[model samples]
Target chain A: MSERTGVIHDIGYRPYTGPREGRWGIVAGLLRHGALSTFGFGRSARSKVLPFGLLVVTLVPAIVFVGIISFVGMDSELLNYAGYQQVTAAFVSLFVAAQAPVLFTRDLRSGAISLYLARPLGPAAFALVRWASLVLAILAFVVTPLVVMFVGGLGAGAEVRDELPRFLVALAGALLLAVLLATVGATAASLTMRRGLAIGGTIVVLIFGLGATAILQEIGREQGVEDAAAWLGLISPFVLVDAVQHGLGDAASSFETPPDNPTTAALMLLIALAAAAAALLLLVRRYRTRGSR
Target chain B: MTVIQTRVLTKRYGGSKVAALDSLSIDVGEGVTGVVGANGAGKSTLIKILLGLLSPTSGDATVLGHDIRTEGEAIRTAVGYMPEHDCLPPDMRAIDFVVHMGRVSGLPPAAARERAADVLRHVGLAEERYRLMGGYSTGMKQRAKLAQALVHDPRLVMLDEPTNGLDPAAREDMLALVRRIGHDFGIPVLVTSHLLGELERISDHVVVLDAGHLLRSEATTAFTADTGHVLVEVLGEDAQSRMGQALAARGVAWQPRGQLLEIDPADAPPDALRDIVRDLAAELGLGLVRIQPQTGRLEDVFREEVPA
Candidate 1:
């Protein structure tokens, strides 16, 4: 065995005099690895189970709806581009919660992050790259089913003019949802080292934020506070993105009393953008103070 | 070239009065330089500060000509650090982890994989590189850690207690690898160990630290040079005392240590001392077993009284 596999070209510790891609390469490398790891690509078989299972589970609804709508020529608004994700947000949230720790918490918990920070990549860049990776991963989860739906709808005889525009709008909402969920998931995972806790915390924060915001919006409408109810949409990422879509008149509202007007929608989109920026800043600071120094 | 130069580097955690690394000022040159100290003697603190992973309280240092304060990332880019603690993720394969580390240190993807294989083989982790590191023995894990450090082909490497949990045979294997990294591979190595003997066998220079203070920093040859003492063992009744008396008559300083007499040839040439001892042994009717010169040890640095 040794003879067959012996190192014939053991050139012995040659110093790399070639060109380095520098810090950009480092960022790109980690970003790719983090994204793949979220869905357990490039990892052990056991790790692939949960992520791929959740992914298949999420895509099932899109496939079933598309199959029925295509063959029967029955059109339902529920199978619309943005409406599909709005309905299946639970599985999407579950997928992010289960996988965020794979990228964010494992290194911090195992002290493997010190190895990463030992490079030229600073803490701010490290956190940002990781956050970006999650955004891409979550985008994959939300985009796949929508793409399937759109293709299936077109093949099932939907008009390109009507469906294409709606598909683009849904794609935009998916991107927004991706960024918002990535921010929330990465922040929650970075808070603690415990894997189960990180997963639990992310799911709770997302679901509770939506539930609490809905209650507040309900209270605001009951008290006849229209502006406060629209603003309260900012508290939950699900409602905020949904409210934006509704206000733009692209997709139907997921919430009761969504105040479906262009003015409130514009305000909600601005609040979402501002909230995403603030969350990114907080995540970077969290990593910095942890001495990713 | 000087690999590391620190000036009054000090580190204190939180509101604690005692510093982890107190006023440490040292220069590490090329080849293997061993940093020796007990646990909490600031060996780890010094490595961390030099790597730019920790901020020193009130001093400055330069690694490979980059100032630690302003050019920490530049310094980190040029140096590879193997932390003393457990840094490996259990579920990852050794090859994957090392390749990832190479990429993190800025190597291109394809090169990272190639260099990862090379370094893992160099560290004697070639065959088992496919296994998850969690299943590895302490020896294999340490080798994996060392492989990751070398994967980037770093200009200088700081290994904090690489022999921490190795068995005797494994420790020998590790020291030999460290020696090759410094001597053959031509990468300047700063390896640390609490055991002086291990470092003495491999390091070219030795820096001793005790309780956050610099005890001594000098060449290994200086620490382990000939002590001007000749050991004499005689086989006869009262042969040890007789040899001692004869050596004293010849104006030699004699100290007995368990059936062997160490005679210092004060101002006498080694050959002259050997001739005198030969004649004295014959005249005293003692059978001289052997005469051997004694070399000092790095351990004696700790045995000596601390200087003010």
Candidate 2:
């Protein structure tokens, strides 16, 4: 056999010559990607069905209400800002229940959490950014209709100066509702890797809590324990948000009165905030351990 | 230079009586180092601890000068890891998954995209880069996993069972790629396998683990060095007996080893022994076919060192 020499060819494997934006860059990229995923952007058309369908369902009522008020004139009985969340609470709840799994459970099931944790970002930052993404998406879902109503009421020649303060209060209530619902939904979804289980758990927690509390309050009312019945509203997330709205003097039109006194309203607000805080803690703790293990 | 160092590393899983890893210490340097062990031998546990994904029950380790306990993130940033299990997200396209991983490893957007493409091509997956990972075959998936690990240009890479599910042809291809990663690219590679002899051809050094205990650690050449015994083959009826009789008549120390005569060159230099064998074969009218030294193998080392 003749002697032979090997030839070297350049395959163009270049070293990275650019800046590596450390932890915050990773967090930002994950946050942006997660937010887009929540609304089904950058995914197949089939993924858009539930989130967009719920969104359109939520917006149609606002559009029709605006059209009616535009033609029928601004009566005080028209759908007010504070009553918007109460009217659409079910749609919002279903929206969160369905979409929260898209944000939390999918990663766990797919083992994508390992990829995320392998980066410069820690587990706490990963959880926080994922939670923030859902919060912003749900916040948009909750606030969009309210903004439309405020603009519609003004376009219908309702006095802007008088409606403005109530609009601001409604906006605050919607923000609070969005945060609390998001916290609860994400925490529930984080508990399991199965999307079906996560959705069922979230619905049972929110809807069952509402149903159980409503029954207890009715019994309290029949027994003439007015104070106890008022406090029972704090157990359900929806009733608690409504109570907060009432405390802020922006009670939904369906409520005959605000929660009997300021004490019940204050307790409801504190309890909702505390529950949300606890859920947030649980989410962070879960990711911290699960991501590493 | 040492790329990985562990001192008295021990790990006990929750509620488990036996430690997964028990007082294991190892130092690995640059080049291809193969970690060989059986199933449930703490290979995955050791990799996880080195990556700082799991804390050791006691003791400590360092990867590329960063403490595994305190600077896990820093260590992760510098060392690329391909896990043993199927951890890829099925929904993502290979390009997107690899680019996102590059981003997560701290590369900027444009650089990440560029590097992802480069690494994909390097791993010989350029044709399937655009396809979703769910549609990939086992070989394709392994290549894609390898692509993501190399996208960030890490100084050290830990590949766990890269050829676990490949056919013989694909296993050869994967082993070649691993050899290229260590030799051509000049990057340190720490690859793990359960098959003892599979890594004998590529690894510069080999470390064997049995039941989480360090069985042996040595250079590949050392493990497979010549055993100083020459096997002689002859062409004739009853060739073995003829060769043994002829060699014994010449005062050569010889024994029968299967079909060949084993020659021990006692009190004679290698050259003088070869001359004596040649002269004896000619005088005895025996056709000498071959004479070659026996070499040790990684499997032999494992069999001798690890207790059944």
**Top lDDT: which candidate number?**
1
Provide the TM-score for each candidate, comma-separated: 0.90, 0.89
Residue runs of model 1 more than 4 Å from their true location after superposition: A1-10, A76-78, A215-227, A248-250, A259-276, A289-293, B233-253, B256-260, B267-290, B305-308
For each of the candidates, the C-alpha root-mean-square deviation to the true structure, in angstroms, is 3.5, 4.5
Model 1 reproduces what portion of true contacts?
0.72
**What is the TM-score of each candidate's chain B when compared with the real chain B?**
0.92, 0.90
The C-alpha lDDT values of all candidates are 0.86, 0.83
**Which pairs of residues clash in candidate 1, taking residues 3 or more apart in a chain or in different chains?**
none
Off by over 4 Å in 2: A1-9, A253-258, B15-17, B231-290
lDDT for A23 (candidate 2): 83
DockQ of 2: 0.52
| Cα lDDT of model 2 by residue, A129-226, tens digit | 88988888888998899888888878887777777888887788888888888888898788898999899888887778777877787787778886
lDDT of 2 at B154: 90
- In Å, residue A61's CA in model 1 sits off its true spot by 2.0
